[model samples]
Target: MLEEFVSLGKWWLPNNPEVVVPGKLSFSPVSGAKLELIGSFYSSQFEEIGQVEGIELPSDFVSIEENFNLTSRVRIDFIKPEEIIILGLLDNNEEITLYRCSGRMKSFEFVKNRPNLLFNIACIFRKIHFQDEQNIKLKSISVQYSHLEQWIGKSGIQAVILEEENKIWISYQPPSNIHLTKIGSLDLNITFSPINVNPFDFYLGATYYKANIEQKTYLTIQNPGNQPLDECINLLISFRDLLSFAMTKPTSVISVTGKTDVIQTKPIEQANGSITLKEELRETQVIIMFGLWNSEKNSETKLSPNEMLFLFSDVENSLGEVFETWIKKRETYESVFDLLMTTMYTPSLYLHYGLINIIQALEAYHTSKYEGIYQDKKVYEKGLYKKFLEVLKDFPSESVDNENGISDEFRNALKGKLKSQTRFTLETRLKEILSEIFCLLPPNFIGSLEARGLFARKASETRNALTHHDKEKRKKAGKGQELVQLFHTLTVILQICLLRELNIPDDSIKILVERNRVYQKEWRPSSN
Candidate 1:
């Protein structure tokens, strides 16, 4: 569901500032937030005294509707007490633009009906812009994660309860940040902004915390000659996805903002008196958002640090080690990465596909990270396969390749089959990934050795079942709670496989697996 941000203000095309249209800008979840304009064209046509242009309002709307590029609708700028930049204002609805004439005007102006405007969506930038461009320049990017404090488990205060004495004690102290990690050439720091709390506020029921602090982790590119906005956003979004994977749920980004520029100066003191100066960078800040990831949530789910795949101690922790490999192989792994991340937001009925997505993600992961060919084609082609093809080329149409005896076309048909025949099957690749990952973690992290074998067979068959809708394989495929267990198993496997790919130590990931609450809960596949 979309939250609402409404502004009652005047809107005008940047080029036609004199013809400001009085209207309100509204955004909601329904119909994806369209901004409607009332009395737009007729009001503009009747500017000042009654002087109608050669063209009629209705004709202009019709002409613009036919030729959208010919109109002055590149961007409709709105201003409340604060300014709003509305980019890409396309007419959203197919319904006729309503129109009604004024009661009386005594001139040609009265004849033109006022038409209403509806614009689909536009990126709303509340700050100033020097000029409009598809991509923006950024000095640095700041990102805040939902429940970051809960994930980091760091704060400025603690509460202690003595149940026997029926006494409660609260203590406040200074908060500190965790160690910073470097992703690619960028430095990632999780900084906190603490707000001083008063004990008196709790008695008034206006506040809940003894102390409040917010996590605003920011990234700065190392030795960047010209900081690229896209690069920063990539790392931000990539890490956000990793966090989503960690939380076992999709975590909304509280805010993502770019600071385009900053300036620093020292205050000056004159002989007559001392002077203090304060200033802000012009058009320096702009907030960025993806419409689907609305920050406001009706319900919140918080987890202990140990419950997540990402384990952090308030004393010692680093996320960069795992993320380093992710960034380098991000493009290669993008397909699988996106597939796995989507399952977090999937509906329950479609969760059967969640199992399917993990299987696809695993297959994709292996394809990208491992050689899909089970054996080299040249090895077989130069010897047995070559001999077989030579025999087929001259066979007198009485040969056998299988149940269907060979024809002259058999040679060419065999050539086509050879391409895929040399490649590994989904079952083989599944086992290979399983075998390599097993040595990296505790023995049977998913289950006992036999159970692990059963998981691999069922997963591979299920992949075949879902792909071709094979009835027999589908009968053996995971379903009901079995599907749920398999989904959880594949998730843990992918998470650990990625950790190993990143060169994270075996011992480190094993410790995370043992500590993880969900992994421990769902590790025993036989329980299902």
Candidate 2:
């Protein structure tokens, strides 16, 4: 899925020496075809014997020859006058092209003297494999045969079924024991009674989430217990299933808890509203944990509002210049990064880079806060909306220029890229990629301008913090309680932003927001 070959003659011999009755004779090819030429080449011979009347026949017989060499063709004859025949081999030249005979005859037409030759010449064909297709493997083989005019009507192909309790299984076996694994497909059908198992008991566990505005996601997995699971097992979770609740009518808060080993997650907060993740699992689970964010969705970081206003103005003012430069190198990602770097200040970038503990707390607060609104919509919705607007109004302001010599043009360009977020802003383009930072929920989450703006501001801050650190700051950054606080705040913030999209519960959302606030109390408040 075979090509060129020559044909040979067929014959029937009756009691003659040159053509002995019911005997086999091997013939050699004179000129064409390739042969491995195993051992020596000579004419083939065979003898016929009558079977004892009551002896049962064996399915297969073993031949003890080293190998047979054929020059061109061979002939076989049977003493019995039975018209039935089964062709097992070509009995002629070997194949060189892409067409092959399946060792079965098309019609029962017997050429008076030529019994071997057929109307259509046979060739071999080989199939081509593609990169994407799965390589199919043979699992089992079977064959069967019956005498003509059996009681079950026709003698060919009968099904075998195995039954146990309410279950059934089917298979087929060939008449001979030649181990013909290449006989192709045989169907099997089975049904069985259900086996009971606990829904909470699992061999493995993991979680993930996404946000509506960001491209990144957060993910975590439990340490499988004593028994190790096969690595081939995959983690699969459908966004449609996870976000099904988000798309549905709002509900009350729900909560669950376990050892830290049972869950994997990033810090809750960052400059951006929150993060989200989606999971893939090898098996399905009915019960799962989801954390809702409680940080005020509309709540603003200290400098968030002013920062947004400044960047928004700077972007509008420099739009024409930025777009012009962007168009010149529109094909590259650097053009976009350069644009963002222009408008975002060191503090903004610093927060965006996610280095400071306060930045993480900010992210967590927003994530949990917004998530709580969805969880306890009736109680929190109006207040959260008010806070969100207040935060936006008081957002941070960027310095007109930096002494470090990072240009205003570059800052604006960078912010432009980050804000617009085309496919060009993928992690592949950025140096310290933030795939987990900006988690977008699968089904798409919506929020007020303040909620959205806070998320965007955090993203800018996280980026700045990551890229703008000097040697002195780097030296002072230690693996202490601050680092843990940063991660927790980051997770809480990201989780809230993600959960809002998921319509997570108020209790779960508040847990993360409160967690972040606890950590943020230790750090200096951001400059507005």
Candidate 3:
């Protein structure tokens, strides 16, 4: 792995591999790049001899000796290792080798014997490829959706079970029928590929040792049309977001590696300063998810942390369809998805913000899913606020732009209220969202909010109290643990709402939410 990461000081183009420059490649999880390259600062030595044309020197050596000194940045091509070649096609139909070579002239030296220029570049990439391929078409990519192993429960290494019947001893070995499972569309499939293990038996004079096949689930994504690498990465991230929401934990990306079609003759061997992948090389964070149960995919045995909101195995059959539907509405669900993820990712994050975020997410989801107005747009803008604006237009403009006047000050205040005027209040949206999602939850999961008449109004009070720091209003809001519970309850509601957005059915959503260990234990229900 280290060998794959370290590159010798040089790089070049595939079409023109001869012109090599002095540079080094660097990338990794902990050791991302602060790259550097050095080039000769002055070409005076060559110029003092003669000018070069098609050949190294002039046809007539006596033409002139032009002195080339260090004045500006020098442009040079570099060499890439011949074994692993990669190419990227641009939108303009021009093809180019992909390189993450980004750096600017750092310093030029005037020292004796050795004077050179330096370049400092940052080579870490997350959202886009370094070459700015815009939308790079990738054949396939490998990613580890964290905690997926525990969820899949399909590691072929099964325990050897022993049984005794009618005084006779017998052994019952768990079946080894594990195979790769593929899900999702033909153009894009999510494959749960199991690692291969060799089965062997070793025998000594009086004893024999049988080797069991060890298996761990591997995840790979395929894009038939060679979809953009960035999109594929987003798909990986989005699916992970779904997992994180389902598990109620911050599940970081485990590992990522991509490959172009091997038939393209550019099988990545050791990509130096580029995203080029070779031999399935990877840089990932320390292992965070571990196996809880030792069983294969076909086995009914599975385990999950009590904290998980829902187990992947429970909804997996429907997940391909769920993910397919969910991701298509990225733009529509971006706000709610981000807010939900933010709460999940940052567990110690301020609870006040979490409450506010979920509430905002509810508002955003409702706003997108259903369209309504507190007052019709024309009625409010033209009939309502317009009357105020008209009256203000006749009045003197804001005197000195201060708030104490009935001029532009009042006018601006009314305009500020315009956007919210037609939208549902935080309280109205909260009740509306809860009313719909509560029907999808287990019976009295959070008790009957309508009968108790406490959750929604108190939530609105708390949101406004914390947001505006309203001391008087704070009297009605929850304190400390109560506030945290409010936030937790709201987080649960948003999770269910998002599942509904994925077209998960009402009864299924109810069962899934009830199965949550935290939902069963931690949440406090409204009193009857």
- Candidate achieving the largest lDDT: 1
lDDT of 2 by residue, 1-528 (tens): 001233332222122224312212121111212212111111322223423354443446333222321111222232122111112123453211211112222222233322221212121111211111121111211111111011112122344445555543332222221110110122211111123434555545533243122111111123223111111011111111111112111111121111111122444554686765534322212111121221111112222221111121223233223323333332333322222222121223333333443343333333333221223443443565445545444544345334444444664565454333222221122111122322431211213334344434444444344556656444434334544444443333334444433333445444434433422422212235
For model 3, state the Cα shift of residue 198 in Å: 7.5
Per TM-score, the best of the predicted structures is 1
Clash count per candidate: 0, 119, 9
lDDT by residue (tens digit), candidate 1, 1-528: 224566555555543456656555555433334455554533332212233445334433532222232233332221111123332222331111111112122223234545555544434443443233323456556677665666666666667999999988776564665545765556676666545567776788784545333334433333233455456656766776666766666666566665555444557777879787656555356655334442345226655566677644522444655566666666768888778767765534376678788888889999888868856878877876787767666665545545555666765787778645777777778788888888655555666567667778888877778778988878887677767677777877888887776666788778776667454435355555
Comparing 1 and 3 on TM-score, the stronger one? 1
1 against 2, candidate with superior lDDT: 1
TM-score-better candidate, 1 vs 2: 1
Once superposed on the true structure, which residue ranges of model 3 sit more than 4 Å away at CA?
1-34, 38-98, 110-139, 161-214, 223-228, 257-305, 390-407, 418-420, 449-453, 473-475, 517-528
Candidate 3 residue pairs in clash (backbone atoms < 3 Å):
11-78, 11-79, 12-78, 12-79, 12-80, 21-78, 154-296, 154-297, 398-408
**Superposed model 2: Cα runs more than 4 Å off:** 1-465, 472-479, 511-528
Against the reference, the lDDT scores of all candidates come to 0.58, 0.27, 0.54
Count backbone clashes in candidate 3.
9
